[model samples]
Target: MRILLVGDEASLPAELSDYIGDLGEEWQVQTVPDGNAAISAVATSSIDAVIVAPVLPDLTAATLLGQMRTLRPETIRIALIDANASHRPPSARIIGMAHRFLPLPLAPEVLLEALTSLEELRELLDSPRLRSSIGRIEKLPSPPHLYLSLMHALEEDDDSSTEDIAKLVAADPAIAAKVLQLSNSAFFNNGRAISDLRGAVTRLGLATLRDLVLASEVFSAQSLSTTERNALQARALTASRLAAKMLPESSAQLGATAALLADIGLLLPGVRNEHDPAEEGDDRPGHAEAGAYLLGLWGLPMPIIEAVAFHLQPQRSNIRSFWVTGAVHVATALASGLPVDEQYLARVGVAAKLDGWRNSANDLITLPADA
Candidate 1:
């Protein structure tokens, strides 16, 4: 991977260069003294990621990263800021620009984890065609304003109880539902459900819920018609619940999230492979890869991404045992009123459990509809 480092030569991390060199021969790192230099480098070459320091010679970190938003829109951006400074706590806008933030004088472990995530995403999205298609995603919904309010309330008021936070999210039902969805998913919860918004907020605490609420922005279905949006939401909600039932305790949360977000790609334009005839036949089916790509880009866990990416084609995955991908495939098929892949299931070692799984999904047909 090609990386661009932006800041003063001294302001940047001291051992960062040594760490990058240790990553191996395929990695290349360059330091740019200012925002203009960083922009020029990105424009002239292919840089997979950029790291920013608090002080840039020509521009602030946010300004440079904001410009990079268009220059290499898909490139990963990380900022290392001194949280202890008097003028600390960057604005939400700045926080939003960098995919992840690290304290300045960065720890080697934190940097390694960030780099590993980048490399893993690259490996998961190895398809050049898919990468090109994802690049055309022009309409990423802005981070929700409600989330900003939630963050402020949680941080500023030490007395703010879980109920207070839940009240804030509940004020916007649209955002509240998303909170519950993520809370119920394996990302936040253990294996069981957290049905209420307050419970979700309480379970997620301050930091975890902030990430979930921000992640919820992609769930916005404004691009869809009322009819399409409602139908899809109903299906997703039911599928997520049923998926939770199908998976074992250890895997339920991831399964629910995968099933819920499996169709999220349908909300974005240019998500389908326009030039690839094989993927052009049906947009709905193609949504699996698109949604997975989008989630992968958002830095979700690999299991969730893989589950959504191959929901319709579970056989594409090595089915050693029943897990997130299998649960999502079964639940989504049942929710959509389609037949499960019996032939595939017969070989998956879960054919006997199919009866119980389908029985669990049967009640989902009545869940959000005719209530």
Candidate 2:
């Protein structure tokens, strides 16, 4: 992995060098004093990732990230900002530009975690067959008109209101319905129901509603059959809600989004391999792998792609923590009425929590009938 640091971190080079040396060959780090040099390196070299500081001498981090996105959409872009940096751009704007928003005076481990995520994602998805499957896809989810309108209103208008966003969503009947349905999800119940589109938009907030619009478009994308597609989508949505209930509030959104898109491969035209299930015991890739590959190709954040890739096979994750992947795996299983991997859960030290999760699922009406 070659990382480009676009900041004035003096000690970062030595610290990162010590760590990178231990990782052996194929690891490189280069630092540039300002955004112009960083852009030059990025344009000329096969840079895998770029980390920019909040304050830049020549260019704003946002402008640099935007430039990187245009140059190499596949590059994992990150912003390192100080929490106390008053001039830092709005987090929403930065998050939209960069895959991650790391804090300043960065810890080596935190940066390492970001790099390791990329490695793990490659380990899970590196396959010639998977590449061919994704290549066959003529197109992926193109943001619908309403979604574009929402983005414009948020970006161009500082005072964009919930009602204004709701109006944009409501213009497209499909997205509005999904947003309303998601807001009324069993996991998000706020005592009273959300019957109006504006109310639903308010409940979910702008960022979440924006993501859901994309998800709704993907689920409703043309596939083999509407009946089959709707079934997969409904099941996915149910698992999404269940997955959210399994994790703490901090990770719930990631868990939900990952679960919601886990079966995307099955719906995509050329991504699903019929022989995947039979070859599951081997290293053969499956729908989970294919969907993850698609997400990565689209330049999504690594954590989301990682969770989608490993949601069904938590043991393959190697890490034993109850991360987004574990939540998605168990929730998806319970939603589909498939047996949760008790052994895998036990291995992760989360087995004792399964019964409680099961009980909670039992109380919800979202879980689809035993598939």
lDDT (Cα atoms) of all candidates against the true structure: 0.71, 0.71
* Model 1 misplaced stretches (Cα beyond 4 Å): 9-11, 60-63, 66-74, 79-106, 142-217, 273-285, 365-371
Q: Judging by TM-score against the true structure, name the best candidate.
A: 1
Writing each residue's lDDT as its tens digit, candidate 1 over 1-371 gives: 88888887566655787788788999888987899999999999988889998887689888888888777766877777785741334566675566555676777777777777768777766765665555544444433456556655756887888888887778777667767776666545698888898888888676545544543554555776756665776687678878888877788767877887777777767655322456435533266786776676555678888888878878886556678888898988888887788777887788998888778887554323211
Candidate 2 colliding pairs, count: 0
Counting only residues 3 or more apart in sequence or on different chains, how many pairs clash (N, Cα, C under 3 Å) in candidate 1?
Answer: 1
TM-score of each: 0.73, 0.59
For model 2, where is the 10-residue window of minimal lDDT?
136-145
Model 2 spans with C-alpha error above 4 angstroms: 1-124, 141-160, 177-196, 203-214, 273-276, 279-284, 367-371
lDDT at position 271, candidate 2: 49
Q: Candidate 2, residues 322-370: lDDT per residue as tens digits?
A: 7888888888888778878899888879889999998877776552221
